[model samples]
Target: MKIRAYRSYFIQELESIFGEDEAESFFYLILEEKHQLKRIDLALQIDLTFSENEIKVWNVILEQLKQEIPVQYILGNTSFYGLDFEVNKNVLIPRPETEELVDWIIKSNTKDSFSKNIKILDIGTGSGCIAISLAKNVANAQVFAIDVAENALATAEKNAQNNKVEVAFWNRNILETYDLEEQFDIIVSNPPYVRNLEKEEIKKNVLDNEPHLALFVEDNDALIFYKKIAELAQKNLSENGQLYFEINQYLGKEMIGLLEKMNFKNIELRKDIYGNDRMIFANR
Candidate 1:
């Protein structure tokens, strides 16, 4: 079948589930992932045909999409902070907002007159996206990451290796830990901030397929992870060190209040590209 002909069918099948533009985007994403052919390649070779075997593979992917499975999981990988990471059911797919958080850390470090050998820790490091990105971007960064799930830590370890950056991975639950063995110049976490009550606000594709442990907290205690990480940072962060978090968009004021109550200095809440209060920074 001609690839162009297949494109119409693919888009029609997914348009109801993901909007027209997103469904169209998925087609090009799959095209590049499966055939190494970009949209321009398909346009130039308008008569490009798919073999029966290729069509079968695409059909299977289409069925999964119908079930609201994330395309990143279908591809088994995703790009974040200009780096590739392997993703699965065990770990959350890295999001663009988290990329902004990583960018903030890198930019802040670059502007500061800190020593080259900086220690950084990423709590609840699912897929190790933040930690790996920081290590890759910040020269002389010593990155460490911890996750409660052993499977998540395993995935994060592989991601660290795949990104060609060394990050120490630990299988410890941050909620239970009182102290980190060493002080860090920077501490960052994109922990589970999605409250249980906010599950309806999440898309079906994410709510149905993403790992819940890495995405949610009890609605009554939405700031559980944030509070614990901040408390630990108070003890383990070096003098004048920075703490960063990708927070729940709805809890901006509450987050600021928590930091203020903790006496963290120079606390700032920043919005993502979508103008949502999605990240926060505090200095200890």
Candidate 2:
């Protein structure tokens, strides 16, 4: 079958679930990921053909898409901070905003002086995106990741190996922990910050598919992870160490306030490309 005709059919089929523009993008995303064919290649080479077997496989993916599954989950992997990470129902898919958070940590810590290496810890390190990215980028840095879910830790371990970076993975619920046992020069997390009240604001794909344990908290305790992690940072970070988090955009002020109450100095709340108060960095 010619790829164009199938692409058009896919677009129309998904138009009801997503709008026309989104459906178009989603179709091309699948095509690119599955076929390794660029949009320009498909457009310029109108004679491109997909085997019947290929169409059958794509149909299954299309069905998943129609059900509002995230394309990254359907693909079973995603790119995060320039590395490929295996993603599944067991772990949250890495997001571009989280990439920005990783970039912030990398750039912020690169300017510091260390004795040939820096010790870093990533709290709630689902999929090991932040931890692995930091390990891969920060040469000679020792990175550690902690997660409560055994399955999540397994996935993150696989990601660490796939990325060819050695990260120490630990199983621990960050909320219940008082110490990390070792002081870190930098601590980072993209932990659960979404509030229960904000569930409706999330898209259907995320609300229905992603791990809620990594996404939400009670509205009254919106900074649950931030508070706990900040408390731990005060106890576990080395002198002049930095703590970073990808936070709830709406709770930037709240996060800063919590850090200040803990006597965290040099606290900085930074916005992402969308100008939302998306990341916070502080010093112990």
Candidate 3:
């Protein structure tokens, strides 16, 4: 089958469900994944074709996309913070907004600030994106990641190994743990902050397919993870240590108030690329 023709059909079938632009993105992402053909290559080689077996595989993926399954899950991996990560139903796909939080951490604490033994902890480290990215970019850093789901931890561990960075991955529920094994120079998390009430705003691709345990909080207790993680940071952070969070956009003011009431200093809330209040930083 001609790849060009299939691309048109693929985009046309999905354009209704996920507008033309997004449908085009889905088509190209699969193209690169399966054929190693970039959009430029497809344009140059106008006669590129997919083998019969390859077309069968693509048809399956196309049907799945019709159900709004995320393309990352269909491919079983994604790129985050310039590193590749494996994701499945067991772990939440890493987001670009979370990558911004990582960039902030890396920029602030480069090799200059990291001693031979600076410690960092990532709680609820789904897919190990943040922890592994730090371990890859930051020098002389010891990284640890913990998640409640053992399956998620397994995926994260594999990502760390694949990224060629050393990270100590643990299966621990952050909500149940009172204290960590040692103080860390940096503590970060992108825990479950999406409120149940906000489910209406979520796309079907996420609400239907992603792991809810790593995504939601009760509306009345929307700040549950932030409160607990801040408490843990208060106890487990070194002197002048930093705490970072990928926050709910609507709860920035509340997040600032939580850290302030906890006596965390130098609080700062930053917006994501989309101009939503999406990340927070504080010092203990």
Candidate 4:
């Protein structure tokens, strides 16, 4: 079928399931991934054609999309902090808000006062996005990452290797241990923070397809991972070490209080692009 004509039908069909914007994004993303054709390619060559085989593959992906499967999973990878990371049902597709967290870590460390040769740890490092991005940007810093799920760690390790950044990957559940066996200059986490009660707020794409172990927490213990990671940081962080978190926006005040109670100083909470309190940083 002519790819140009198909794009309109595809977009119109998906518009009922997802709004036109998302459906359009899905179209472009698939076009680029499948045909190596960018939006500009389509604009310049409106008569581009797709072979029958290519159309078959796209139709399969379209079926998955109609079922609300996340496009990253369908594509088998995603970009985070400008680095490619492999993702599947085993890991959460990196989100824009989490990108802001990476930006916070990168920008915070850019100040020379943080010192070269700084040691950093990324707790619950799904796909190693945070750790790899930090390692790539903080040239002099040594980065390590920990995750409980062996499959998730395996995926993260591949990402580190693919991104050409060295990151120490460990398979240990943060909730079960307080000892990192080494101190770090910075400890950052974008841990599971969405409360079970918020399931309705999550889209079917995420709830059905993303790994639940990396996306949710009990409503009664929404801060469990944050509290535990913070506790470990209190003991494992070097003097003046920085701690960062990609937090649940609703719990900003509560998270700051938790950090203060743990005696974390220089505490700050910042919002993401949507103005939700999405990140917290503190220092020992």
Pick the lDDT winner: 3
Question: Lowest summed lDDT over 10 consecutive residues: which window, candidate 1?
Answer: 107-116
Candidate 1 segments whose C-alpha is farther than 4 A from its true place: none
lDDT of 2 by residue, 1-284 (tens): 99999988999999988999999988787788888888999889999999999999989999999888999899999888878999998899988889998887777666355557789999898899999999998866999999999999999999999989999999998888988889899999888889889888999899899999889899888888888888888889998899999999998888888899999899999999998999999899
lDDT of 3 by residue, 2-84 (tens): 88899899989999999999999989988888878999998999998989899899999999999988999999999998888
TM-score of each: 0.98, 0.96, 0.98, 0.97
Greater-lDDT candidate between 1 and 3: 3
**Residues 1-284 of candidate 4: C-alpha lDDT, one tens digit per residue:** 77789998889889999989989999998888777999898889878898888888888988988898899999999988888899988998998999999898888778575555989999999888889999999858899999999999999989989988899899998899969899999999999999988899998888998889998999999999998998898889999999999998899999989999988899999999998999999999
Q: Select the stronger candidate by lDDT from 1 and 2.
A: 1
List RMSD in Å for every model shown. 1.1, 1.3, 0.9, 1.1
Clashes (backbone N, CA, C under 3 Å), per candidate, total 0, 0, 0, 0
lDDT (CA) for every model shown?
0.92, 0.89, 0.93, 0.90
Which 10-residue span in candidate 4 carries the lowest summed lDDT?
Answer: 107-116
Residue-level lDDT of model 1, residues 135-210, one tens digit each, is 9998779999999999988998998888888999888988999999899999999999988888888999899889
- For candidate 4, give the lDDT of residue 90: 90
Residue-pair clashes, model 3 = 0
Ranking by TM-score: 3, 1, 4, 2
